[model samples]
Target: MKQLIVEIDETTEARIIIAAKTAGLSAQQWLKRIIDEKTVSSWPDSVKALAGSWQDVPFAEELRSGEGREKTY
Candidate 1:
């Protein structure tokens, strides 16, 4: 596994230590869990179900197709 280093203020470090203790994990483990959560590659179900749902809306193609640029004088 690769290693990473981060520099944080004393107050923030203290907060992480306290949070780790509350969750019964070491500070390194708690930080790793947070990084894993933020790096997940999956989207939520609500957003996944919205695919192609707006294709039929009025002028949706013209508004989003990037083909109509304003002419400058």
Candidate 2:
């Protein structure tokens, strides 16, 4: 197998570690499984605050109905 080197930020490295632990795997194994096209056993645990009011029931319903969902960043 060919060896590859990847450079990432510290935050990303931390996330990788979290993801690896979530799947009960080492970082190398996690990356290898990803490269092998296996489904990720655990998702990365990052939370983002969505823009919405607590009482915005209508807006929440609209969002859930696929009315105002963003495709991606």
Candidate 3:
């Protein structure tokens, strides 16, 4: 695996350390988890589960089809 180097202020470092300790992880593990979350390639399960839940909402194609729109020109 490749390695990364970062520079953070002391206050930020202290905060990270404290959060890691609270979560029972080392600073590196906590940071890695955060990076993974931020860089995820797919929608989260909670968001995906919301699909088809709104029946009244128009799909993108329908909204852009210009139906019922008043022509100004």
Cα lDDT of all candidates, in order? 0.90, 0.78, 0.95
* Top candidate, metric lDDT: 3
Give the winner by TM-score.
Answer: 3
Off by over 4 Å in 1: 44-73
lDDT, model 2: 0.78
After superposition, candidate 2 runs with Cα above 4 Å error? 38-73
Encode model 1's per-residue lDDT on 1-73: one tens digit a residue.
Answer: 8878899999999999999999999999999999898998999889999987997676867677766677578
- Please give the lDDT score for candidate 1: 0.90
Ranking of models by TM-score: 3, 1, 2
TM-score between candidate 2 and the true structure: 0.46
C-alpha RMSD in Å of predicted model 1 compared with the true structure:
5.8
Give RMSD to native, each candidate.
5.8, 13.2, 4.0
Q: What would you estimate as the lDDT of candidate 3?
A: 0.95
Tens digits of per-residue lDDT for model 3 on 6-66?
A: 9999999999999999999999999999989899999999999999999999899988899
Per-residue error at 47 for model 3, in Å?
1.4
